[model samples]
Target: MTAVVEQPPAQPKVKAGGGERGLIDLVLRFREAGILGALVVLVAVTTVINPRFLSAQGVEDIFLNASILALLAVGQTLVVVTRNIDLSVGSVVGLVAFVVGDFVSGTQHGVLVAVALGVAIGAACGLVNGLLVSFCGVPALVVTLGTLYVIQGLNHYIAHGEQISAAEVPGAILSLGNGDLLGIPYLPLISVAVMLAVGYYLRSYSSGREFYAIGSSPEAARLAGIPIRRRVLTAYLAAGVLAGLAGTLWLARFGTVVADPARGWELDVVAAVVVGGVAIVGGVGTVYGAALGALLITTIGSVLVVLKINPFWQEAIVGLLLLLAISADRLVALRLARVLRKRNVRHG
Candidate 1:
């Protein structure tokens, strides 16, 4: 009476449909495609309005001006993609810039040493932020908000109503800030390199893909054995390093540092990241889009000046653009959800 049981047949894999609807479905799944289109339109319109916008010198100026902001936006994109935010980057930038200026102006320090000190200080501050948020289990917004005040206060205390002037900074460092390579500024070139590195990592590496997975659905990611906490801490750490790098660049460019050098810049950085198609709730974005967003915002500011529009209008325009971006994000999310629901229903 040794009887054998029969096994069921294997189910066939269902091939995905191929057509315009499929293409639309793909686009809806990634909201970045739409933002990319918008960025192209913005560039075209700006170039049309002022052909000078495409001039070599003008293009270099735009890239140079957008460089630091693009760096900050990339960091902001990482945090936002993790469903978190860091409000302390502006203060971090100011503090690090001031520190580097102080060191460079001091009798004992040189350009390289000053840059190293500033970067180290920035990393320390970011480490504190990461620890507070990741280990203490505090909300990132709350922790960074507190750190913002703390860091700003530290900056004021250290500065003690003093400012470092451009005259005191070394010529070499100043050159770093102002010099161009083959018609492109060094800072913008560095920013592009960073964007490319980060973009490649997030798109191609396993650990990088894990970040997207975690952002897309933390619970599912956890169940799938992803190291969620470590990944988040790593994201914050990367952000902090970039913030430090930006501080160094700011120091080089301005050749002067004040306690409030980049005050309120976090808003612009966050806005750029959001406008670049990084979801506030997490999961989607690219450094290229973030850079484009930075360029767009910077261009709008320049256009305002060129058109003789009030500077206040620049801020207003940024606000409107952010609102529009958020609205578009929500609409796309809704469409994707509806499509997913229909697909699930049909499959079930």
Candidate 2:
């Protein structure tokens, strides 16, 4: 009889947990899930309250309206994930919108050239912000806040109290903003495509993981040889580009641009990013969640109008939701701290 060696026992793979604990773990591990849940609830409630809310036209309008904010929110998500913020997005949007409008309305420029110029202008602004924050080591919040004023001032001076009219806008440019493809509005479709691309990159790429690492612990990320400066700079650049794109969409949708278009929009972008579950402290969120947050906020405004709720109450409701989101974040952080402490004690 031949002696046969017994094969080594197979190693058991660790399985992730499931059920309510799993759901809680999911939310804690990825805060975006909570924002997504809130979005679902908001949609369901609105649909129940007004069955017409589910109509195709209504859906399209909601998405189209949300697209501009969603684009800015995507950039905000990237910056916030790296424990940074950009307070100049609103101004960037306004300035870029005006630039694009001016170009298109001028006798000298074509639609393509105008669009290119608009995007480049936005990118340049972002680069300046990045240089100040990353190279000069200025705080991001301060740098962006200053840029906010600078850009807004420039916009006002350039416009000189004038607004571009719909009659002056090019047909091609207008179509790009207001037209639809395969039944989906162009603006929303563009936003969806961008969100998907950015989301994938953040979730699937090594550099993206580095962003999360930096946000989670800057010191550790540095020790691990991650290029923190480069990543941060790149984040700002992406933000500028997205802001430009949003500005373009805005011009098309509104069929004009004024000096102060999208004023106070930075707060809306920040709120969407935070509400989508990106921790204020940094290193935890998803673009999809942020987009959903934008949708929810936009829907809330529309729903309020439809329900005939007092305009003042809309702000109050939004404030309450924001408060709840912050509270949830704190609870998760505390629980995580307790878990780590218990584990340390056990190890000791």
Candidate 3:
């Protein structure tokens, strides 16, 4: 009589689908893994064709070339994650590089003062950009594009067709750029530090997570009590600061600054961000991925030079890769959605 009622079978647990979860995790990582694989293959082939491609000097050159772009890509990632773009970054870099170089060239300012000035200049630009996009309700593309021309004009007027020469750069600043720690170059070290810091913040903080939320669905984010305007403004400010820092580094690395030093580079930055797995559609990407994408872009150019390929083909190859990346991202997203749907229904 006590056992008259049979016990119902227990519902299956979600942990039962561990295999599916693992697979989903792997799929999520496919973008970074694929880019890494491509990089390894490209480097191997280029090194085989010209062993000097992996030589010490060649390696140094590649890192140096990738550093500034990687830094800019990191900043762009912040903005793009929130469904916005900053076309003015290249102009900001150019202006900062010119102004900082000119200031240091004329004054006895040390490296610290020069860097502080550069960062301040960058902050000012970021504030302007943030105010326009956040408060005025202007589209990011329009706002940044307009600022691009304004910054370029200011740079040209300030330059008056003059350029900063190598001799004008201070020894300490040059050391900061070109010096090494235990045989590791400083430029790459700086870039790595920055990428790590930003990456960590984005991964671990609520405020950072809000960026993706806003990008994924603005209305939902707003309903969740997220401050969309503040987040978006912060993104633009971060981008501006990074661009400024990149400008200072540019001067240090090249020891020469022109009014339009970074012209046409905005396209390259966007391309790298896209190829690095940050969706132009927003709400998907990582700084680490963006940095790798920058490296891949920079490496392709070096590989071409090593293989003695025509320089013109460099841009073409980049475009092809961009298209392929976009297609692959689409496929992955579709597959992920299907898998997630199946998992949800099964578990439910």
Candidate 4:
């Protein structure tokens, strides 16, 4: 003990800006958290204004209304996550719904056949989009926009001023649309199941993770040997199939088919994607966020109607939300830049 030298006071261990960077990452990574908070606030305020807004019927109506849009948003997420867009989804839905109605309108063509046909039609549309974008290297936006027009034209030409009414829709198909278990509506259930499955795949699968990689940096992904074209093609295929499935579900739920059932809905789907935190420039969002975004929009519409606000205010509100998302994204980017700069200096 007498021979022991006095040790210098120990310096406090530090990870530099670990805590600050962690907080930053948490804020950036949990982008959907903000959306969830907004939803809770919306529900609370609306429920306070109108007790019936929380009524069972009102809740069911909101979920039912949101189901199809949620599905569209899910598929749109796949495309968007790969730094691509699918503007043709709405037209694809319109096309598939009419096709399903035409195929199973009167005869007992059964549920399976009608669904299969719609899915196939959608797959074809997706394949075309994929081929052009992947092989020809055309911009996703341009290819999808062109396909949207073509599909819309084809749908209208096929319908030729005709509509399919509930009476003509098969009972089997309608049953799936309207049926439920334990008092839960099938449409919302199906939409939720689809969202969960896609969400799981995106979060857990290697291929799915590659979608984000591609979106994050196409050139880097190619250097990593990620088969960019194939992944992009598959994304389009999945989107088309979902759109087709949604089309059939659309017919089932509404029991009425028109030449343009989902016309102008592409914008809503994109809005939902953006609102859900999926960057329009690409790589940063989740399907769950997209689904929530869809649900929130539908809920907001219901709330506004209950509150007796001017109908015009709805679109304006949505536009404001979009702007907020963009602004938030900009803020996040700036934060990351600052964080990296600091880390580099500390290591330098």
Candidate 5:
């Protein structure tokens, strides 16, 4: 009897109840679903308030406007998933846009060169950011903030109070930007392609999964022999490259390129990321969710215009939504914690 009792004690013990863990997983999986539901609700309400909001032309404008922002948000999602931030993305976009404009302004460099230049510039900027954060051990927020200012200043110096006018922009690039496919604009189509590609990588690759591991627990990530610094560097580089791509699109969409286009867009992208269900502290979010958040914000702007509400009220609404998302996340985490505790006590 004594030996049998000792053997029972030697058995492996199960930890937290699966019910709690399962619930948490469900919440995580449904992050994008929740955002989608919210989007549906908002669209339905707006469509009812102003039937014209759903008109074909109105819908086109909304998707077109959201595309650039959605692309930025997708890039931002990658970095945030690794538990980092990139404040300089907007500045990078502005700088790259001006450069691309100057490169092809009066020349026949074509859209391909402009595309390559934008992505290269953005990637270089991201590499710098990643290196500084990874090697120098600087906090991401501080490093990115500094880069933002530096890039913005550099952009002004390069432009020197000059701007790229519509006449200077190449027709091919502009045509590509303005072109549509089967009733869908090019911008949204590009944004969707990028989002789907990145989303697939993050979902399917082991390297991509490491991002979440790092964000969830850096210590554990390190212990598991994951190269935290390299992963982080890659994340920032991807963001910078995407920002560059957006810059190209910006120049194409709005031929009048100025020194400070896309200024102050950092906060907007971050807001979209947060509202899309990506935790600000890191490790939990999908590019899909972020894209949806971007679309939703742009839609809100359109809705406001159609409803004749104060234009400035859109910001207020977005801020409120962000706050609500954070609060909900906190509540869910607390409930999970309580459940784990109860399960432990019961098992004991």
Candidate 6:
């Protein structure tokens, strides 16, 4: 008899679309890694130049300064991922800060009440924006730009040229802004928590994925049965909510609010989002990347100051970085498309 029955040949292991996903994820990680590396190099060089830059106080200052901007950037990510923009966020923040400050200072409202008021005001503003853009089919840029001025006008009228002094702010709110748990500042902690939550939601949820789909191709997503309007509305609502929260935090951190607090901050928020890998064209970006981008921008400002560089150069440097980031993003997207096509053909 034969020594043994012939062994059956093994079938090739199947991986489904694992290779494609892996490649896509690798590209995304590469973008984030590049930003992180830049941040490290910048920090290291600046620290070497000024040892004070690495001191505990200096480090805290960096995180503190970046926290609010990072929060705003995270909110902007939601809207940008949906192929929309919220130019009025700065105005919303300014309005909320002043209103909330005035309300809190004159009344006996606690932190919770002040925060709720801020959120409500923000939601109302967001609702107007969502309705206009989603239902009316208005261009987001034009709609938000209009709202920006409207909100600013309202803020100034309400302010009546008045400002909320530090004495007017509540102790609890100030504590929330400045106090720390263990060794970390509350502001940075809150910013990180919000970033992680939004990042997880966008990465893991089906609805979150739909935002990207709509942004990538509205027609395709619509054909696929996604409620594009609702999703867009939700994104705007979220951005408004976060802007409101940021406004509250702004009050806490600064403890003084003028009619035009955070004026011109919208540009910085957009810049951070763009630099963090969120395409201005939409559909591809992560909250994590956006937060890091905010941190990088904040660090750049600090570095310039520490190195005694001209303040005007900070804007120039940010603009240069923004250009480089956009170029990198476009290149990566093209490479990813090519890879996907090759994989599809090979699989077929």
Best by TM-score: 6
- Better TM-score candidate (2, 3): 3
lDDT of 4 by residue, 195-302 (tens): 999989987988888888788778778767788999999999999998999999899988988898899889888888889988777767888889989988888889
Better of 2 and 6 by TM-score: 6
lDDT per residue for candidate 2 within 155-215, as digits (tens), equals 9999999999878888888887878898778898889999999999987898887777788
What are the Cα lDDT values of the candidates?
0.81, 0.83, 0.87, 0.87, 0.88, 0.89
The CA lDDT at 127 in model 5 is 95
| Worst lDDT 10-window in candidate 6 | 8-17
**Model 1 residue 63 CA deviation in Å:** 0.9
Q: For model 3, how does the per-residue alpha-carbon lDDT over 1-348 read when each residue is reduced to its tens digit?
A: 476888977543212146554654465478788889999999998889888899999999999999999999999999998989999999999999999999898556788887888888988998899889988999999999999999999999999999999798888888878889999998899999999999999879988888887886777787677889999999999999999899999988888888979998888898889899987877788898899999999999999888888988988988888898788778877886788788798988
Best-to-worst lDDT order = 6, 5, 3, 4, 2, 1
Model 1 bad stretches (over 4 Å):
1-55, 106-111
Q: State candidate 4's TM-score.
A: 0.90
Ranking under TM-score, best-scoring first? 6, 5, 3, 4, 2, 1
Q: Cα lDDT for residue 308, model 5?
A: 91
Model 5: number of clashes? 1
Candidate 4 achieves a global lDDT of 0.87
Whole-model alpha-carbon lDDT for candidate 1:
0.81
Q: Which stretches of candidate 5 lie over 4 Å from their true place?
A: 1-21
Q: Write the per-residue lDDT of candidate 6 for residues 90-193, one digit (tens) a residue.
A: 99999999999999995657789888999999999999999999999999999999999999999999999999997878798888889999989999999999
